[model samples]
Target chain A: MSARLRRLWGMIRKESLQILRDPSSISIAFIMPVILLLLFGYGVSLDAKNIPLGIVIEQPDTATQSLAGAFDRSEFFHPQRFGAIQEAQQALAERRIDGILWLRNDFSSRLLSGNEAPIGVFVNGVDSNQANITKGYIQGTWLAWLQHFAVAQGRALDLPVAMEQRIWFNPALSSRLFLVPGLIAIIMTMIGSLLTAMVVAREWERGTMEALMVTPLHMGEMLAGKLIPYFALGMGGMLLSVAMALYLFDVPLLSPFWLLMLCSALFMLVSLAIGLLISIVTRNQFLAGQVALVVSFLPSFLLSGFLFDIHSMPEWVQTITYLVPARYFVAILQTLFLAGPVWPVVLVNAGAMLLMLAILTVLVVKKSYKRLD
Target chain B: MSFFHILSLARKEFLALMRDKRSRIIIIVPPIIQLFIFGFAATYDLNDVPVAVYSEDRGGASRELLARIEGSPHFSILHQISSDAEIAPLIDDRKVLLVIRLGQRFSADLQRGDPAPLQLIIDGRNSNTAMTALNYLRDVVLDFNREWQHGHGQTGPPVKLEMRAWYNENLQSRWFIVPGIVGSLMLVVTLLVTALSVAREREQGTFDQLLVTPLRPVEILIGKAIPGIVIGLLEATLIIVLMVWFFEVPLRGSIPALYLGILLFLIATVGVGLMISSIAVTQQQAILGAFLFIVPAVILSGFTTPIANMPEMVQWLTYLNPLRYFLVIVRGVTLEGDGFALLFHQFWPMAIIAAVTLILAGWLFRHRMY
Candidate 1:
């Protein structure tokens, strides 16, 4: 036991030196997180604002002008005026406009006479999420215009089925709240798996694995030694991630700091284990790096519940997500960051992370070579 | 500039790529897996949204409302909530995405022609889902109200909103997303192959051997640039084929124009890859540098999110990404059948990007030639 500890100590020291010497590794470990967080936070948004809503009105009068004005006034839409339906259809095809609001010549007369008038709202529904939001915003504009019209006429009205909607966790409907927690999970996956995967595969590629194999070192000691520095690096990256989430993006960290850290640490260990196992199996830096990305980073980004909700995915894909430990990590992170100390979710996801860690650790041990064949 | 010298170098690159069995599998396998994963996973059409309905009034009207919520494919009502205490835990657990609370006066108010207050409590951690669910619920309630008014011989409001979605009538997210996925896959595959090529040679000390050879710098540059462009074109073609034949996204645009866009886009990406390669000293550094470039390019490229939705400064920054323009071109061509004449605005930006990057890569190569 003493001998194993001493060997692990020496390996850790050597591995730390290698990590320190490689300037690129250090940059990847630290700088990449900041870049990813900023890109996701500032650049990627679900809120569809400034949607190009083309408006076509023939012979515009006061009522038609106000109707167009309603669309123009709304911050959600950038209402561009068009002269003809042909021009509007061309804009729709070019994706220059998300949807079009065509008011016929009879609209003004219909509004004055209190007759049923329907304005044509032709949307570019290729991007459905944006299209759905566009529909909602247009509806809101219509309601706003009607309320103003009713007020002008001095008509008191009572409506059936008043909808009082309340958003609980993120009241302002900021996309950051959803993306930040998911970004942390994604960053942690890269830091833990990709970095560690490269480190181990690099040792093999540089032919230092042969030397380590000749020494009186246990395989477990060497594997853990190679992974320990990266684990610390990943934790540093995690702190940087949470700090960015809290300070840079102003995402509320609702749960206890310890609980959040605990979840991050667990997920980090699983990712590192995956990297170590891939490095051992591939035995080449280039192959290992590619494999790590395919299995680790890509899956974490796509398969994890970070970007796409797992509940909405197809059944086989959902089953595939069960194998991706980042999904569980994202669940934990989202709960901790958005909803404070949701214990059952934390416990379940943590247990899943530990199970994956156990499986990956066993694979790492099995794949590590005692004698080079 | 020498034809034979460039040919030999290009052949060497082709050999280097083909020699690796792992890379061979990688080039072919990702397209299929990605196609499958994207087809199934990348959907915004909300399905089976678990909702909890709590009714203080368990009358016929209340039951009908709950039945309405259950009926939509958008929602999957878990169970009726008996008390107020059960609502919080269900939402907190996320077992129930939303809680519909019906007041005691709901049925009585409905019968007496008074407005019924319906409270929708949504867990807004995933705000997109919450908003979508709310919209679905609103539509269901509207339908129920329309039916009730028809039965009672009452009329709806004056104006009717006749909304129609063009190109994609049902607003299926697949039509919007699949084209971008093809572009994303092409970018990742082509970027990595080129980024690693020169960086690996540098790491292995073979770059010095090439530098000592009689081949001109332009020849070496051509040798490095061609494989990535060819591979990128092939990838773009493969993805387009899958999109048209398999995924069934309509090919409305001119094929020649789409291919022209692909060619220009590849030039830009390959140039970016070579630029990273010239700076990186090792394979690991090359991979990281390439990833650093790729991640932000894809994010800011208007692939997943719209560039117009971003802040003013960020929108200005997206002009630098070639994929952004390509995404527009591909989506425009596929959906709108846009010819080169119609797509002139999208065409010039990508060409400018390609020329600039190629010139930059050449300059960077010359400075770092030692």
Candidate 2:
């Protein structure tokens, strides 16, 4: 046992020296994920307001002018006037405008006469989410205008339905709330996979693995030694991200800090195991790195519901997502950040991740033990 | 200048690649898997969002509103909360997305000629889903108002809304996304492959032999770039065809124009990858360095979200990325049916990036030792 400990400590020392020597590895380990986290957290958002809108009015009337004026005053829309619907539609297609509002002839007369006249709203529904939001703003603004007109005339209002909207968890609909937690998952995945994948593969490429294989160090000890530094690096990244989330972005860390760290540590192990397995199976640095990226980074970004909701995905795709441990980590991180942890769900996900770690660890050890000749 | 010498070197490289089955699978499976995943996964459309409704007023008007919420395919009522406090727990726990509050005076207000107020609380942390829920709620309310007014035989000035969506009329997010995915995949695969190529050869001691040969620095550069460009073009073709055939995404604009954009974009990407390959001593450094470049490329290129949504400084910084211009051109051509005239805005930027990166990579390749 003492001999094994000495050998493992030596391996750890050697690995740390190599890592410290490589300035690029150090930069990638510490700096790259932080840059990615900040960019993704602040740069990408689905909730868009102040969309530029172009309007074309064929006739100038009080009602038409008032409607255009209302749109101009709206916070959600920035209205620009165009000479022709063709020009406005061209702008819409070019992505210069969110939508175009065309006021037909006799619009004022029809409205004043209490007739059902349809207003032309040409929406580029290609992005259905934006289309839906743009439609709501237009409707809400028109309804408010009609309500104000009715109140001024002193007529009994019919169909008096009112809507009160309350947003929960995050009342302000800040993108940081949703993005920061997911950013933690993404950053951790990148750090764990990229760091471990290159480290193990580097030993093989440098012909150092053959020397280590001749020593008293077992595959398990070598793997453990490799993982220790990265585990520290992964935790460092998590804390850095958490600081940004709390102080800078203002995303609440409602769950206990220990629990958050525990989940993150477990997820880091799973990601490291995946990278180690890739490095062992491929036995070449270039192939191992590429394989690690495919299995780890892409799945974490796409299948884990980091950017898109997994529930909306097709069933076959969801089944494949179950193979990705990052999927579970993303869910766990969101629950812990937004709502305090629920034991049952957290335990189930954590258990699944533990099983994945066991499987990957076995595979990595077995692959590493094979004869190089 | 013997053909046999060139053939022998090509044969050796092909043999080496063939010996590793893992590389073959990693190279092939990911493009297909990611193409399928991105085809289905990267959509802005919200469908079958789970919502919870709480109605305090159990009158006919409230029932009609409930029916309207249920009728829309976009929302599926998951639970019904009875009290206001339940809303906080539900949204906090993610058990429900939306809570509708109908006041007790709903029926009385309808009969007494007063505007009845309804309150809707949405979990806006997931802003895309929240916005969809809000729209669905508005549509239901407007439908109810129209029916009520028609039933009473009272004609009043009807409220009309004008909506126009820009960039895409069909809201085919795939059209906007597939091109960006093409750019992203190229960034990941091409950069890593080329970045690792020379470094791995150096680690294996084959680089010294090649350097001793009469092949000029430019010849070695061409040899490295040709394989990357061929692989990049093959992957791009597979994704573009899958997007058109399987996803049913339209190819509205000129094909030559799209290819021209992709060609210019790949030039810059390959140049950067080759530059990293030349400077890196170990394969690990090459891989790590390439990754640092790829992550920022995808994020700043407007793949999952809008570039305009970013801060003005970051938005200005994205002008440096070649992929950003490619995204705009591909999405613009596919969705908007835009011609070269409208797309002229993108061409010069991509050309400039390609020229600068290529020059930098050429200089680095000559100066840096294996």
Per-model DockQ: 0.69, 0.56
CAPRI verdict (incorrect, acceptable, medium, high) for model 2: medium
Best by TM-score: 1
lDDT of each: 0.83, 0.76
Q: What is the interface RMSD of each candidate, in Å?
A: 1.5, 2.8
Candidate 1, CAPRI quality class derived from DockQ? medium
> What root-mean-square deviation over C-alphas does model 1 reach?
1.9
Q: A255-361, model 2: which lDDT tens digit per residue?
A: 89999888888998988888777777666787878887777677788778777777677778878889988888887887788767767657888999999988887
Best-fitting candidate, measured by DockQ? 1
Task: Tell how far residue B220 is off in model 1, in angstroms.
Answer: 1.4
Query: Which parts of model 1 have CA positions greater than 4 angstroms off?
Result: A59-62
Measured against the true structure, the TM-scores of the candidates, in listed sequence, are 0.96, 0.92
Which ranges of candidate 2 are over 4 A from the true structure? A116-118, A152-159, A341-345, B1-19, B80-89, B103-114, B162-172
lDDT value for model 2: 0.76
Interface RMSD of 2: 2.8
